[model samples]
Target: MVGGMHQRKAEMARHSDCFIALPGGYGTLEELLEVITWAQLGIHEKPVGLLNVDGYYNYLLTFIDKAVDDGFIRPSQRHIFVSAPNAKELVQKLEEYVPVQDGGVAKLNWTVEIEQPPPPPTPASKQVGFPALKKAEIAL
Candidate 1:
């Protein structure tokens, strides 16, 4: 049966052996990130990998690199997510993951929220309308 994020956390805490994150949505990202956080904090030591089917995770890999560059995440921490465009290499990385000290994580008081740009404002009152087609110029 499907469960909530909390339940999934408990499940992961129970496993603590291996995890494979395939192409997924928000929930997948959340679960993988949490496990990586636990590993960073030394709470758990496990392997995490991304099966980047059809370049699904290319953008995500770039974002993680940006995270490292922006100092929001560490370069070593980038090891937490192994990216492979195919299952073979992905599984291999997961099999070979070796957990080492991630140093420290500064606790930044922050709130997590998904941001989406607002829609553009509408014109005053549809003032700009399509040109009226002339009956004489119309072709069947």
Candidate 2:
């Protein structure tokens, strides 16, 4: 099992192919932003998303738009992730999602800082969990 929050996060990053954030407090926001930043840095090619339940993240979305408007963030980089109001739509988006290959931001090599050794491969007969998720993972 993982130790502190950081170790859990490292493990999560190691396993997940996609991330979808739910409405919550600071920790939720931090995890969402960090994963998005990881995509920006080319640390991972995972698709990130938000479940904007009841418009909870409207302000945050607007602020991100303003950042693009103010030139603090690039226009292409602004669409770093998809946002939807529910799980179904979010999953659909994640399925259709594509990683930003040329967002103009320099792809940073954060390898040494965030890399974790991979878990040993499980034997074929001992396979557990969905060997093939026809889908994704939520970040909450």
Best by lDDT: 2
lDDT of 1 by residue, 1-140 (tens): 42455555756566566777888999899887887776777666678778889999888889989999999988888886577888888888888888756567543322233445667777765556444545445653
Which residue runs does candidate 1 get wrong by more than 4 Å?
1-4, 105-140
Clashing pairs in 1: none
How many clashes in each candidate? Answer: 0, 0
RMSD of 2: 15.4
Query: Which run of 10 residues does model 2 get worst, by summed lDDT?
Result: 131-140
Kindly list the per-residue Cα lDDT of model 2 for residues 5-103, writing each as its tens digit: 866886798888888899999999999999888888787888899999999999999999999999988888777899999999999999998888885
| Candidate 1 TM-score to native | 0.66
Query: TM-score for each prediction?
Result: 0.66, 0.73
Give lDDT: candidate 2, residue 68: 91
How close to the true structure is residue 10 of candidate 2, measured as C-alpha lDDT? 64
